[model samples]
Target: MAEKAPKEMSFLDHLEELRWLLVRSTIAILVLASLSFFISDFIFEKILFGPKDPNFITYRFFCSISQSFGLEDVEICDAKMPFIIQNTSMGGQVSFLIWTCITAGFIIGFPYILWEVWKFISPALYAKEKKYAGAFVIVSSLLFFLGVLFGYFIITPLSVYFFGSFNASPEIVNEFNLESYTSMIKTSTIACGLLFELPIIIYFLTKMGLVSASFLRKYRKYALVIVLIVAAIITPPDVISQIIVTIPIMALYEISILISAVVGKKELMESTSK
Candidate 1:
């Protein structure tokens, strides 16, 4: 005998499920954040302030490339980061530590969060689709982490370098606040992480008949402009940094188009076979 279909859930049941999902996700984040306190010093000094140092890996890598190309005059080769980060408020340090740990926990617990989200939505999916839950969570988490790394290594350093080095007047000193610096890092990583989910999002949108490969292709030029705009918003107001950020995003958009095409084709085949 064939297996019976799952029973339909009531509106209240769905809400209850959603509530549990949030509860579980929050617990996971909190647990991970608590663990982060054990290594808070490393996070603050090595990871957060890494970009602020002139000898940071990103800066050194760029400096090497400049020297190889005989672009010694390029400012990227300069060994100066004329800025200091300070906390003005008495409670600022404590608040920053707590929030930063929370952000880190969110990033680390992303896979668990995705699993909870999958469980919440799995009831609505066909059995075949539900079986791919593991792959979904893994791929989504991988993409998110990759985006975070890209943001940290590429966007954050560029933003720090540009803002840290820029002096409107010779007498002005760049003393950045702790909150502002941390905010920039958080924004860059989280923004890129979400942006990197483009292909996954496009796949679902195409599957839902909300978007199409043709639509994406037709608006490719517009997408390019939008990508550039996002890059400009995220990176320093320089051609090079914006272009560096734009390249990956545009590539993701192209990949999203391809994903949409494949999903569209699969749906078309399924409909035709019916």
Candidate 2:
């Protein structure tokens, strides 16, 4: 038997559908977050504090890279990082656990959220368009995870190293608040994960006629500037670090342009055929 097509929905019905989707997504997040609570110890101790140690994998890799240049006294190979983490408030840890689980929930539940979002949007898309759902979820999830890894290994470590090693004077000691430290990690991971969705965003924008390949190409230089600025903001104050971070972002932009162009051409062809 053929599947029954979804009925055309009124505006209120659409809103109701969206509300349910959101409710479901939230439930999925909370469920995953609850699961995360059990593993909070591992998340807190190993992954969160790992970068603070000089012997962390990322630091060791960077030190290895630096040594290849025969730079013996490179900052990355330091004996110890120069900061300590502390909790300033009574509810600090309780607050941290709740927020951390929520963050993990969001990350882990991202695929389900995308599935819900696709269900909402699928009614509006053509049969052919609906077929890309799997691709959309997989590609987007992969991009987000890649961005998270990049932020953790490259951006987070670099930021940690820069701030941890920085001292105004010998008299001033850098003591990082637990909340502040976690915020940095969360921001770095989540922000980069979202940023890596640029190509996907452009694809949709192009479909909606809000952007085009020509426009993206024309503003390439401006986009490059913006990319460099974002790289500088996230990375430590160094040319090499900025370039290292900028490369993947620039590639994403290029991918966005390509995606936009493909989407544009497909739309144009469809209109011409009609």
lDDT of each: 0.87, 0.87
Q: Write the per-residue lDDT of candidate 2 for residues 83-158, one digit (tens) a residue.
A: 9999999999999999999999999988889889889988888777788899999999999899899988888988
Per-residue alpha-carbon lDDT of model 1 for 58-82, expressed as tens digits?
A: 8777667666767667677775888
lDDT of 1: 0.87
- Measured with C-alpha atoms, the lDDT of residue 4 in candidate 1 is 26
Model 2 superposed RMSD (Cα) = 2.7
Find the 10 residues in a row with the least total lDDT in model 1: 233-242
Superposition TM-score, candidate 2 onto the true structure: 0.93
Weakest lDDT window of 10 consecutive positions for candidate 2: 1-10
